[model samples]
Target chain A: MAIRDDFEVVASQVRTVVQRFALGLLVIAAFGAMLVGKADTVLVEHARVLALDVVSPVLEAIARPVAYANRAIADLREFASLREENARLREENARLLAWQTAARRLENENEGLRSLARFREGPEASFITARLVGDSVSAYMRGALLNVGRRVGVAPGQAVVTGEGLAGRIAEVGENSSRVLFVTDVNSRLPVLVERTRERAILAGDNSPRLRLTLLPSIAGVQTGDRIITSGHGGSFPVGIPVGEVVETSDGSVRVRPFTDFSRLEFVRVVDYGVTGLVGTGAAAPAPATPPGGTAVRSR
Target chain B: MRVDGTLAILDRWGRAALPGTVLLFFVLLTLAPLRAPYLSDTLPLLPVLVVFQFSLAAPERLPGPLLLAMGILLDLLLGGPGAPVGVSALGFVLVRAAVMSNRRYLVGVPFLFQWAGFCILCWGFVALVWAFTTLWTWALIDPVPAILQYVVVVVIYPLIAPLLARVRARDPLNVPELSRGSARPGETTP
Candidate 1:
């Protein structure tokens, strides 16, 4: 009985001491965490990148099923709507056939004109097609991953496009997967021109839905509804590809409605133009002409 | 010696089977990508699972430290910011303790009442954390969708709860019985 009483007394005393120490520790920990939170944004971003690198493959593996299931559900819903869609498809098909024939005829005529005029040969480029794997739904960084990666010849800085127009470019490349920075990403910029007026401007995205056309001189002849296309000034992307249509906002700033709907992206083509030496060659050709012109101008 | 023996048994079972099965199911569900996008947009099911695990499982059966570790592992697997999970899980355990303290009142209450109470507490905690982090106003201010999602989860809770409960009850290692002893200071019946 005596021993039991002593044990109880000691236990109670120990508990009291431990509880007080724990309370003190908790207060210190809370303050420390707050300080760390304030001071560790860079560390946190680094940790996030490391974590993403580690988890990306697993997430991609998991995302495949989710994407598949979503597609399956969509297919089921489409089956229900198929009867209504068939009649529309028949009429659309007929109209498209006529347009296709006219397009073929024009293409043939353009080839004939090209052979006669001896137009300069554009850089030889090849392309590989890939399927989009996953994307972020949140508003901040709009990007997606594609199944094609280094193994499939996709490289960072390579341009990605769809049949409609420019989608984005490969930002990060893995062995079997690559992340594409969509034109809507805040960091994305493309040198574009107005197809109608040849006015050059920089298209920049600000995490907003619309892309802004910056660096436009006040007197530049650009109008609302003008078509924007690549100018081929930069070797990164080929010129003459349709980008988007221009729209003048209420604030008098111009924005382009991107041709590709990022949310619905599925398939894309990665162009491997093999034009790394073309820029140097073009620069060298201009130099030879410059020396002759300089001597002639001096003699005059 | 008795506690060591019990822990040995739990270690064997935990290592041999339980965690693997749990992990496998989680992976399968993730792979099945069984997503109700519309449902998830409004009500996240993963947080509800976390809350449920805290409430129904005995604390001694799953120590706070172990729970935190599991939560972190889950965060890594789920590919999100990792530390929020550890913090959220600790919060869940604290709330569970508060609720379980009034077991007499809660036990006698209808299952629906219990679920509603549990969801309200969970949502309140989640909203508070989200607000503290300066998330968009739409996250916390829009209560209609939040409540609707909460209700959907609560409605489905009964179906999922029993399965997990059965798994806990049928655990061959008897970790639950041993853990219950250390749950409270006065408890001595293992």
Candidate 2:
């Protein structure tokens, strides 16, 4: 009995020592991984995509129920305000009817002019609707994982949008899953034009709900509610896609609130305008056309 | 007699593996699409709480290698351009280190005291992650979101701690440690 007790104690001590050594090694390995991730972005990105692909199926299964639950909750809320919503929709429908008639007239005139000039058409825009399987949107990162990827021709840099307007663009693609980098992420920089004034600027995200407009023309005037749209300078997104409206303009800094409701995002349409300029095919991003009185910025 | 011994060994191994397995599940839970405004940002910290609870409950079972794997997996799931990937692994190790250093006092303390210790340590971990992120990006990051996440975690801790404590109480190894005639609880071995 005495010998057995001694053996157990020795074994315990040895185990303790081994555990300590392992803890030290793991701490070092963690630090090493951090350094490697910083140095080699491609490796990290590949690993991230692979991980997403592996987890997406499971996320998809979970998303269905969660999406249903969210819809139910929204429905309950909407039911409480049904009368107000119906009245507002009725008013908006009447306004849209008048605009629809004007739009039809303009389309007819534009089509006649195009044929008379023999104007060549740009690459046709195509779309694939995908369900959102995962959401990584946070204060630091704004991204969503989709169930569609290269298998469905969902390439990187394709514009992602909802019925309302622009949401984001594809940042990474795997076999069955892809990631959308939202317009609100710090790394996202988009070329936009103030629709009313036709003045160009760079819309930059700083990991905030509102995006900031940078590189604005010094002489250009912008208002608080000026509409913003893709300038089509960058071939990644189509021209004139409604992005957002300027919510605030103070001290020469303008903030935009995107039309897409990020919190309630469930389904998104990925648009392929067939222009794989910078992100998709490794071609250089085109520089924004410099209007007079403004320096041009690269649309990246 | 041999069969009884085999069953005993299997039970011990199963118990040893439980905490790590549950922690892994918590990691997966973080990625689930439970969409709400500001939810994705705050839910990432759920695994951190799991790590803390398991580190206190069964430090031996929840070893460094498993924590490293869990953190790296979470990093891979969350990582993207401009996002720190392996920093999560570093954070896990740091949390483990913090808990290990204070294990003796924490395991012996009352529930309230343990709760308080957890609050302090969780805040410290959040601050450390914020600092690392700011440094990695070399830009000034707004601290409000991280602080809000910390607040949410603290509020949710009470609901989670008792459940983890129950798991600890049911652990077979826990009884042996208590009966080892140690002056305080959880001081049998480091």
Candidate 3:
């Protein structure tokens, strides 16, 4: 019995010492990993991609039942608000009909003018729709993992949009999954312009619900209701895609509200607009697509 | 007789592995895309809480290396290029080390005391993550989301604490029974 007690005491002492030692070593390793992540992004990105691929199946399986449940709840809510929604849609549809007629007339006139001036047609955008599989709800980041990747021609730097408008751009692409860096992430910076005034500015995210416009000319007038669109200056995203609307301009700071409700994002379209200029994720952009006209056109 | 011995060894190993399996389940749960208003913005730190509870309850079962792996998994699963990797790992180790030091006070105490200890520790954990993230990105992240997450995690700790306790209770090592006689004044064997 005494021998057993001594052995137990020695084991306990060893465990205490080892725990203390491990704590220190782990702390050091954690810090070292942070440094390594910064210094070698490719290695970290590859690892993250592998991790995403492994978890994609599990998250996808869970997403189905959760999505159906959410849809069922939404249907219940819709049933309760059916009358109000019907009245609103009727009023909006009538107003849109008048605008549609005017827009058709303008389109005819614009097409004639373009022919007279021999205007080159811009590249047509093609898209692949993907389902949302994962969400990064961390306080410091705003990103989403999608269920499609390179196999579906979904590459980094492609513009991801919902039914409403621009949501974000693909940051990393794995074999079976990809991550989208939302326009509201602190690291996201896009060249955009005011549709009404044609004043170019950089849209910056501060990891907040609302994004801010930076690098706007000091003398340019920006109103709260002005529509913001991608300027196509950086070639990261296709030009003229609706981004957001200016919501606030207070004390020289301008805040824009994105049209897409990120919290409610279920599905998004990853668009390839044939602009191969922005080579994000250290991967070369795919060759631009050839236009049928035989004219030199970019393709991806 | 040999088969009985083998089965006994397997049972012991399975009992030891229960906490880890539960922790991994919570990690996957946290990563799932359940987008409901506040939940879409800030997920409850379920995995973090598990690490804390196990470290307090039985550190030997969830050692520093496993905690480190959990943190790295969180970082990878977060899938945000904006946030650097290892931030979660760092938080996990920091929390584990801190909780291990206070295990005596936290364990074998009234549940309220343990809850209170977690309430205080969570603040420090969230703040450390915020500070480290800011230094890494070199930007001032709005503290609102972090504060919201902290509030959510702290509020839900009590509801989840019992489940974590039950997991510890299943250990074949009979941890509480072994330590019951050695329990000091005002401490109850859990």
Residue B184's lDDT within candidate 2 is 53
Per-prediction interface RMSD? 9.7, 2.7, 3.6
> Which residue ranges in model 1 land beyond 4 Å of their true spot?
A1-72, A80-84, A97-123, A139-141, A184-235, A240-266, A273-300, B1-52, B55-190
What is each candidate's DockQ, to 2 decimals?
0.11, 0.52, 0.53
For each candidate, give the TM-score of chain B: 0.56, 0.82, 0.84
Q: Give residue B111's lDDT in candidate 3 (0 to 100).
A: 89
Q: Could you say which candidate leads in TM-score?
A: 2
TM-score of candidate 2 on Cα atoms, chains taken together: 0.88
In model 3 chain B, where is the ten-residue run with the lowest total lDDT? B174-183
Q: Rank the candidates by TM-score, best first.
A: 2, 3, 1
Q: How big is the positional error of residue A266 in model 1, measured in Å on the Cα after superposition?
A: 4.1
What tens digits encode model 3's per-residue C-alpha lDDT throughout A1-300? 999999999999999997558877898888888888877766887888898899889989988888898889889999999999999999999999999999999999999999999999878889999999878667877888899998988878788998888998887889999988888987677778799999878888887889999888863499888999887775646788899999999988999999999877899999988774444342222225422211111121
What lDDT, from 0 to 1, does candidate 1 have? 0.55
Q: Which residue runs of candidate 3 sit more than 4 Å off their true CA positions?
A: A1-20, A218-220, A282-300, B1-10, B170-173, B176-190
Docking class of 3: medium
Candidate 3 residue lDDT tens string, B89-135: 88888887787666677766798988898888888888888897777
Candidates sorted on lDDT, descending: 2, 3, 1
